[model samples]
Target: MRMSIGRRLSLLIASQLILAALGIMTSIVAFRRLTHETAYLRHYVFEPFVVISSGIESSNALFDLLARPSSDVAYDARRPMMELRSFVEQYQRDWLTATSTLPEALHLRAALDRAGELGLLNEELAAVDTIAAVVASLERTTGLVGPAPTAPFLRRADVEDLGAALAKLNKINLRYMDVAYSAYDRNRRLILLAFLSVCLAGVAAASLFGLAVHRAIVPRVRRMVTAVQRFRELGTYEPLGDWGNDELAVLAHTLNTSFKAIAERDKDRDRFLAVAAHELKTPLTTMKGFSQVALNQRHDAAVRDRALAIIDRQATRLARLVQDLLWCARISGGERPFNPQAIDVQELARRVIGEIEPVASDHSIRLMPRGDAHILGDPELLEQALWSLLVQAVSVALEHEPVLMTIDADSAGRELITIEVRGGKDLPEDLDRLLEPFAVIAFEGRRGEPRGTGIGLHLVQGIARLHGARFSIERRPGDIMVFSLELRR
Candidate 1:
């Protein structure tokens, strides 16, 4: 699919934003996980250890009171014994609550069950119950003691049993702490690893994306820039290679098309200058030679007259050539001044025929006048265009051949007037080429008359355009070359 430059850049930016968002989300999730883990260690591990340690202290005090003589018991043993029982109960409740409330703890319990080690948790709870039972038994034994001095109420066997239960509970609490610490350590490492992996993946992805985008866009831009710079410095266009269906590609195509056109124009300009120089040189050379001959004192009167006449004719041809070149320049520069007014087409044709008749003495110029037609146009430019057509027709016509000029209304019922010139000669097969400036047309029956400057028909075409007329030439029946102008009435 063809993507424009705008869309490509937009995608690049959007992808980068998406990656950044992912990284931020990963950070946020990792932070929440670590925070939960820290809370679990405090609630379920460290707090339980403190409660168990306090219970052990209370148990020791009770045992010591029982061991002392009843008279030496200054503090109330009942209060201490009751406190010990409450501590053991609170520890058991807190352990169960912490495990149930924490998601991590629940997952750990499920995992332990899967591993066939579910009794690990049950053992801890049972040990807490056992300690509570032993404390309640001691509390009852102490209450039964009389206020008078007596021996310790706890039997020796009961004291040993209570010590063993306390020892087992402490051991269980230590095991639970080990399990909590081990899980925390393992989880902390895993979370850190996941966070690092996400960060690295994001960095890698961003780098690759940047590289891909740079390769896609930067090199193509650089190539276009280089081509423009080279053309500016050397006046030569180098076409760029096709990249893809993107904006840069379209720009390259447009630049290539424009460069090709400029190159063709440059070629045409060079060819025109060469042809123009030759055309101007020819008449000037003739005038120079004839003027030298006429100035020679040794020449007879008749010879001098002949030389002067030749010089005059060449000067006239030179003047006409210069005029045609100037007209072409003016029209091309869009500076040709137009003075349009209503003109009688038939009268204008007669005036043009009269002017060209003297110069085309070898060819008989005839005007086949039809119904009267009038047009709104620039009189001088229209006259010049008609004169060029007539001159061109006469130049190619056989000696004494009839050259026909006609001005009439269009037969097709359209509000148009056609001015036509037909000569008894075949035009060049490439008739369209003649419309271009300096396109030479070589007719088969042309005499020794000087070849045309070739700008005549071009000027005629330009003048016709300025007057909003259509100018064309074609071969007709009877091998006649027809030059035509169709203008609005």
Candidate 2:
């Protein structure tokens, strides 16, 4: 299907916007996931490990106090027991706070509990509490007022058990930290990869779209440019092939139409020149031959006078031909000025009949006036047009036949005046061609020579047009050819 330039550009823009939106949305989703994972590691993984390590240190300190030999062992153990109890309470608070802040951490804790890791850590914490209880009992039994006692209250086995529990707890925390760190790193890499992939896809799509647009526009534009250049150089039109329904296609069509019209006009111009040369040459040749005979001293007076008369007639014909050529040129160049005034159509027809009747001796000229009709026109141009039409009618009419010039108001109730020249002979089938400059309707005169310079009808048409009148030719029922001029009243 055909797409306009505007629609194609709109589609390109829309595609780019859609791709950009998709990229932005992908980035937002990936970033959101990364942020969530970060919070998960901080609360459930790193924070919990810190609290476990602190608990292990507090356990070690208690064991150290138990290992020392002292005169008042209970008094020394009292401070370590209080510190261990405080550490245990603080560890529990920290763990609770971390787990409570993130829902994902709570789920992780539940999973760890199912795996026995959380339970093992809890058991180790309970052991530390038991050791603190033993130290408390010793302090209660050996009062501060008693004499210095050297007996150690915490046994070697108890210390060993406490160390083992703390070690196990630390090991569990380390393993959990490792797992959390691995996952965090993996998720971050995945997010980064996804964002990069989305960006790459957008870039690829944009590149493809750019290439598509270039292919759609560039080749056709180049073709049109090439066609124009070829026409400029060769004076010939080359058709740009069908390029679908686009702006370029429409332009190509217009150029094709204009080029064809120019070509036709050129043909017409060449034809006009050929015909004009023939018409001008004939009259000039006649004048030249007769003038040569007239100038010869060997010629008698009667023969010389006859030759002079023929020369004068040819000159007059040549002059008329020249005048018609000039009028055609002026009309075509838009150089003819129109001076409109009300002119009686009947009176104009009579003047044109009088001018044409003397020359057309073989044919009778008649005026059929319907009424006193007046039309607004350039009087001089209108007269010339009427004279030309009458001359054309007289030349084409059969010998001894009447050539009628009819002037009246339009029969169609329109405010128009119509002047018609009717001749005894039928018009050529291609009557319209007679309106073209130097176009002749083939007809033989009494001497078997062609009558009328082809310019007469063409000049009449042009003059009628200058007065904004309609000129037409048609054949009547009796094979009578009629030339009509309809002018606004």
Candidate 3:
């Protein structure tokens, strides 16, 4: 359905807003997922790794102290051993915290070879306590004698067993690191994929919207522009194609209607010019012939008088033609003044019939006055209108046929004065064309008669309109043609 411009714009904006909201929602969800993944990695993987690594460094320091003699040591080994034991305790506490925070469904089992090898996480803490006891015993032994025990004083088997325990703990920490890191890597990949997907979706949506807008608007604008250009250059444009209820479609319909009106006016102007030329040519030709004759026969008085009379007649015709043209112009421009008064329309009809009687010598003219044919109107304009119609009827009347002029009041409730000219001839099919200025009639009734300037009916119609009267023509039975004017009473 067709809609106004405002409605169409609203629809477009609403669609864009909805799309934008979707994009924003997608971005928010993706950002939240990324944030959660980052928090998980820091707590489960990175933070625990840092604590374990610190404990390992502290253990290495204690081992180095044991490898040296006690007399040569610059600092006491007891403090270093105590610090190492404190780090071990801290590592255990941090491991417990890390496990407590781990998700219910761990994604790290694939990274571990055997859960039993490490036992429970608490078992690992017990092994650290055993190492602390061994270190304490060694420290006591060092203080007792023999300038600190030699590096090989501890049994190879005992040292190897302690190293194996540390190795197992280290292996467990590394394996846990491997699992945490794997989970972190996978989380990173998923976040990246989601972000990329959102971006791709936003771009795709934008592209589709742009394409849709272009398709909807560009062609319509182009068609309108082309139509205007053609109208300017060639004075015509093709009819608009089907427009499916957009704002542009309504605009196209309006413009096309105006174009058609302009074309019709242009056609009318051309036809009027041709008809004017023809009307002027006939009188001018007659005047020229008579003037030539009068000039050439200067010696013959009778010939000159006859030529002058013919010239006078032609001049009168020319004058009337000019008068009709001027009246038409005045009426069309609304410059003609009308002064209306109460007048008996029957008397007006009598005056018009008397004026047209001489012109219709071959036909009988009659007046049929009925009722009180009274109307308030301009007497001169009404007379002119009646005269024009009577002359037209007489000109086209069949030989010996009667042209009747009637004046009467409307019998209907609407009080109106009607003037009708009923001619004894069949109405021509082209009545509308006949009413136009300078329209030529080619029917049997007009065959033997000389054509008038063709402005009579046009002028009559104009005068009738000026009097607020309706003018029309109709055919009745018995081959009667009636031209009528119904004036306001």
- Give the runs in model 2 whose Cα sits over 4 Å from its true position: 1-17, 27-103, 106-232, 235-260, 293-320, 356-363, 387-402, 410-468, 475-478
Q: Model 1, range 329-402, lDDT digits (tens) per residue?
A: 89889998998898887788888777666556667777776665777788888877777787677666655778
Looking at candidate 2, the ten consecutive residues that score lowest on lDDT are 413-422
- Residue-wise lDDT of candidate 3 within 308-402, one digit each (tens)? 87777667656666777888778878998999898887777777666556445567777777776777888877777776677667656566677
Candidates 1 and 3 compared: the better one by TM-score is 1
Clash count list over all predictions: 0, 0, 0
Best model number under lDDT: 1
**Model 1 residue 139 CA deviation in Å:** 5.9
Model 1 residue runs over 4 Å out of place are 1-94, 97-102, 110-123, 135-264, 290-317, 335-489
Models ranked on lDDT: 1, 2, 3
For residue 458, model 3's alpha carbon misses the true position, in angstroms, by 4.9
Worst 10 residues of 1 by lDDT: 413-422
TM-score of each: 0.64, 0.64, 0.57
